[model samples]
Target: MIKVSEALAIVAENSSNMPVQRIPVRKALGYILAETLYSPIDMPPFRQSAMDGYAFIHSEKHQYDVISTSQAGDHSNIKLNENEAVRIFTGAFVPKNADTVVMQEHVLANKDSILIAAMPPQFSNIRNKGEQIAKEEVVFEANTLITPAAIGFLACLGITEITVYKKPKVAILVTGNELVKPGKKLPKGKIYESNSVMLEAALQTIGINKTKVYKVKDNLKATKKALKGILEKYDVVLISGGISVGDYDFVKDALLANGVEELFYKINQKPGKPMFFGSKKDTLVFALPGNPASSLTNFYIYVYPAIKNRMGFSDIHLPKLVRKLNDPITNTTGKTLFLKALYDETNVTILDGQASSMLNTFAIANSLLIVPDDVEGLKKGQLVTLLPIN
Candidate 1:
């Protein structure tokens, strides 16, 4: 068995970014930019009005002639003389020679002219060309994540598409003979199969929607055949059972038969000690324990980061923090413990049902307290590492 940190290092070393592809900016949310993007044009390419008011050349006069009206998306070339104002709405292109704008509420309107009740400063309420960002300036660097606001900002610049790393093609295989699908009658000695859907939903949370699930019986022949076929096409394969040394377990032997290079077999951690990570050619494989809690914990710790790394994310691990423990705890098993907990700003409370087979605690947990193997016990007020999760 290897230490948790060593396993993480191995995964990081093996995971590589996927190929780059140009996609529509609207569809690029949550994707990592594959190239540095430069602003094609100045933001607010022309002088724009910042409010729905009158635009005119600055003068000390309290009265002005209303020349014309300009709203958003208008290309009026109206010019303004001294003490002359034009009715302009927000986001409208301000006419040339206009240097000031006053809110309509601050002016007394007449039939064809307005009297300024409040004389504002020169060049007020006007967004100069490139005020936000200049043309050819770096808008986003390579590896920056695409967010909703990013898409809207790029759209304002008339950018239709952007280059980003493609998400991985993943395949999940659930192996066991005693597992039955949900909504079906369970046999006397069988349990419902849920890891496949649970893992699929977890992948979806990270915007990985292209995934297929397969079922393989607890037999070497079937496991080998399934592995061979999936490895040929997918970039990542997740096996959710049959890795232990039980008589029915066949994933480990099947993976070897399929010629996968084992990078690591197990980690010195509780709830997910029997995890397996390996690769063959370009395809990465992870075999997690059959238990639901163990399977999900290993996914968060190992598989999630690997997938994010392959998608070109620099920050691939779960968001972590340090918080005081609400109660004391002990680790007599001498293994790193991933305890499900509820955390606020200052403290974390470890919940019950830390068993590998139960997910009740995980369902309500907002974070996972990582207790290192070297630590034998912790006091109520001691600080510990916490990983925030959904």
Candidate 2:
């Protein structure tokens, strides 16, 4: 067995990148940018009016002749002379030699001229050229995740398509003879398999879709055949059950026989110590424990980071913070423990039913309280690191 850090390092070294694809910028939200993006031209492309008012040279004059009116999209060449003003609306092009604009409310209207109620400062109501973005400026770097605001910025630059990291194709193989699908009649000594659905939901939460699920009996031949097929297709393979050292455990042997190089077999972590990770070429393989909670926990801790790194994500790990424990907790498993807990502003409350086979604690928990292997227990009000799930 390896330490949790060592297991994570191995996962980091084993991840593989999917090919980049050029996608329409409108449909690229949540995808990582594969290339650096630069603005093609100055944002706004012209000096624009920031508000509805008069456009003229700022001076001490009390009145000016109203030459013409300029609204948005009025590109007619209009130059302002001394003591002359143009009635401009919001987003309209500011006329040449116009240095200021006073609000309409600040000016008294006259038939052919306008009287200034207040003197306006120079360039007061104009959005200067390239104020938002300069031409050829690097606005977004590679590996940056595209958000709604990024889409708008790209549209302003006239960029309709962008190169982004392609999402990985995933395949899940749930192995167990006594496992039955949900909504089916449960026979004796059988439990409804949940690792597949839990894993599917976890993947989607991280913006990863395009997943397929398969089931196989606990037979070595069948497991080997299933593993081989999935390995050939999917970039990431998540297999639940048949990983521990049990009589029916056959996933490890099948993976090894199918040329999946073992990166590490076990980690010094409670709930998911039997987890196994390997890879063949650009494909990553994870053999998670059969327990529902263990599989999901391992996915969040190990699998999620690897997938994110492959998709050109820089912040691959979940956010972590230190919080005081509401109550004392003990760890007797001689491994690092991940306790399901609810976190408020200052403290975290550990929930019950933390057994690997149980999912009740996780349903209501928003964070995982980390209990290091060196610590025997934590006293009330003691600080511990926590990772949020929501």
Best by lDDT: 1
lDDT of each residue in 134-216, candidate 2, tens digit only: 99999899999899999998987899999999998899999999998999999999999888989999999888866899999
Model 2 lowest lDDT segment of ten: 9-18
Candidate 2 collision pairs = none
lDDT of 1 by residue, 1-390 (tens): 999999999999999999999999999998999999899999979999998899989988989999799989998778788968899999999999999889888999987999999988999999999998999999999999998999999998889999999999999999988899999998899999999998999999888987899999889999999999999999999999999989999999999999999999989999899988999998999999999999999999999999999999989999989999999999998999999999998999999999999988899999889999999999999999999987
Residue 170, candidate 2: alpha-carbon lDDT: 90
Give each model a TM-score. 0.97, 0.95
Per-model C-alpha lDDT, please?
Answer: 0.93, 0.91
Off by over 4 Å in 1: none
> How badly does each model clash, as a count of residue pairs?
0, 0
In candidate 2, residue 73 scores what lDDT? 89
